[model samples]
Target: MVTDFIELGFAMESGREIPQFSRFEGPVQVITRGPVPAQALADLDRLLARLRGEAGIEINRAAPAATLVNASFNASDVPQNLIAVEFLPRRQMQAVVPNAACFVVPNVSNWSDFVANRRSSAIDWTRVVSRTQAAVFVPSDTTPQEIRDCLHEEIGQALGPLNDLFRLADSVFNDDNFQTTLTGFDMLLLRVWYAPELRSGMSKAEVQARLPTLFNRLNPSGRRPSNVDPGPTPRVWQQAVEQALASDGGLVERRAGATRALSLARAQGWRDNRLALSLMLNARLAPRDQGEAALDALLAAAELYRRAPGGEVHAAHIDMHLAVQALATGQAEMVLDLTARALPAAERSENAAFIASLGFLRAEALSLIGRTNEAERLRVDSFPAARYGFGTEAAARARMDEIARIGTAAQRLARL
Candidate 1:
């Protein structure tokens, strides 16, 4: 099955058929290379949890087979069922994987960096379809979240549904890495491959032939949205907004860029986009929530949105981020209200990433409010979007999960 995909090169996706594995029978093993800190192992644990529990697909979480600093797949000695996910430094990737076809995880310092470092042919792309072995290259001194984002993407590609399609807005498999976690769409593909009727070693033609029928049968109501398109592309300001929030250039440079972006947004009459950018700048720079005056400014900004010509869907985007912040500050009740404002807009739109991020926040709110079962179900539903929005490693999710678990809502609220 792997050999067949290797000859297929870049996985292509149009409207009709989705990319998937011929067979789905491998135990993914997460192993650290070199001197990885204990925390990385913990982060891997969280990633595996999301993959095994939240993927919507039933990918079993197995223990790491063994750690290998200098390793190559002999293909003979290594068990065929053992697919190793080696986490190592980026520079060490070529050394570990050698010339053998493999997937190289993309790592970015920030969104800007992500934009800069996309799709280099020098990096091997064939291993994703290879029978076994892949690498998650970690740049030195990167945050755990960054490393996890690489894992979220690279590991997922290694698993199956190898194509990274621009049309796929919600899945982590998308090039944007906007949704870090495995999303529902990703789960759908996995389910197709692993379903009892679907067997290992099927051809693309075979899978494509039967998939549409299987999907319809499995989800008669079409719970999964069509993948033809991902709504409208994000606004230019939305893309540039990252420049301001990320600690790139000097503070002066970042501030200047952000100011200009906001000014242009307003001049162009993009009220909703501007509002969202303003809140983002405030959160990253001034952090109005830290003081009464700043809080007033925030409220005034939110109020402005209410009156602005910005539509409900755009407003929902801002609300999603705000809901996450509220959750962080232990305002679970407020998060419920904040996320609620986004829900109506969310349901009315086909923005997959937006929906996933919003749903994950709602789940956080539910968990904080003690709706465990509902929250868990929502978390499972969130799948790829949760990671895509929060970084597949789910740093924000992890922090909130810890906060919600360690203390009562009141206690958490008081601490903040």
Candidate 2:
């Protein structure tokens, strides 16, 4: 005897067919057509017993039995003992049989719904602000007012109108159009403080050209706000030195004038720490006949950093800048010594970018002292890690260009 089971009632919206499971006893048979038979009932009882044992349930507790019949296959000669039982689709079975545990089948259609049900909340800005301040090494409540009020009264007089300046600064800080606001206020401040005469002399286009340098002198430590979406391009603090040189005549008078204004402002309690440092550094690098005065100014800056408590990082940067100045001035021995001192600080602080930079400086000093091979080796060793940590792919590319130039220069000199 044979048995066949077919489930017709169960279906899914996705049009996919569902599978059915059934138990069979004695050779269950499928009938195309059948009458009520006693033997068939016996076969069903046996199948139910087998199913109950497999499911670990008693016979009475098992689900209600279903029968299958087809008129086409009915025959008198067929054994009356044959019975056919049909099982519903697994999903339908769960709905029909109370207390019968069923496993849920998953499908791709509701993936987005699952994700939407489990989504999280938005970020908290206050916590973000605190964390950002900590990461950047900025102190809590380090606002411009606290900085401005710390300077001497005489310095405040040099700043012209304090109320107007503060208002403009506030606007710059709060406005979404940071660069535009900064540029506008800085131009006005420059006119009032530095070169009142030039304000009337130059066109808007000309004023815009000179605005960047003035802005740099004003906010030397922070990144500038640019008109473009990504904001101002990253400029090294040393660019101020170049600007000072390129200013009217060979004197770098604008840089000196800006520095004096900043110093006065700082004395009056202006919190221009970064700007102040940049000005001092530019003053030291200024191309004046008075080398002794420049050296003294540079020493004063270094001393300021050295004397300040917990300013070791600032001191390290000063040391590196001094070393670079030494290299530019043909003092290779001093460059090597300063770089050597800076390396430990750079490494101890885990500033790989600084370490890599010092390595390059050391290499440059070495090359100047007729140690080409050593210089090349250091350049090759430091290039990769420095490139990664510095976050300036173009600067790294430029360094490689410089290395190539140095190699070419060495080769040419050897031929000579």
Q: How do the residues 1-416 of candidate 1 rate in per-residue lDDT, one tens digit apiece?
A: 12222222225322223333343355554555555655556656776676666444444434446666555434354544333444445454445445322253322212222224445532233322334433445543445445556666666665555555432334555443345455555655555555566655555666556666777766566645543322322345544555665544677667666665656556655434255445445544553455554455455455655553323444566577666668767677888898788886665443445666666667767777678899879867865544543444565467446534533554456657
Q: Lowest-scoring 10 consecutive residues by lDDT in candidate 2?
A: 1-10
lDDT of 2 by residue, 99-144 (tens): 3221111110111221232232211111111110000000112222
Task: Please report the TM-score between candidate 1 and the true structure.
Answer: 0.46
Off-target runs (Cα >4 Å) in candidate 1 are 1-26, 53-65, 70-75, 90-130, 199-201, 223-416
Local lDDT at 16 for model 2? 27
RMSD of each: 12.0, 33.4
Which number leads on lDDT? 1
lDDT of 2 at 348: 44
Count of backbone collisions in candidate 1 = 10
TM-score of 2: 0.35
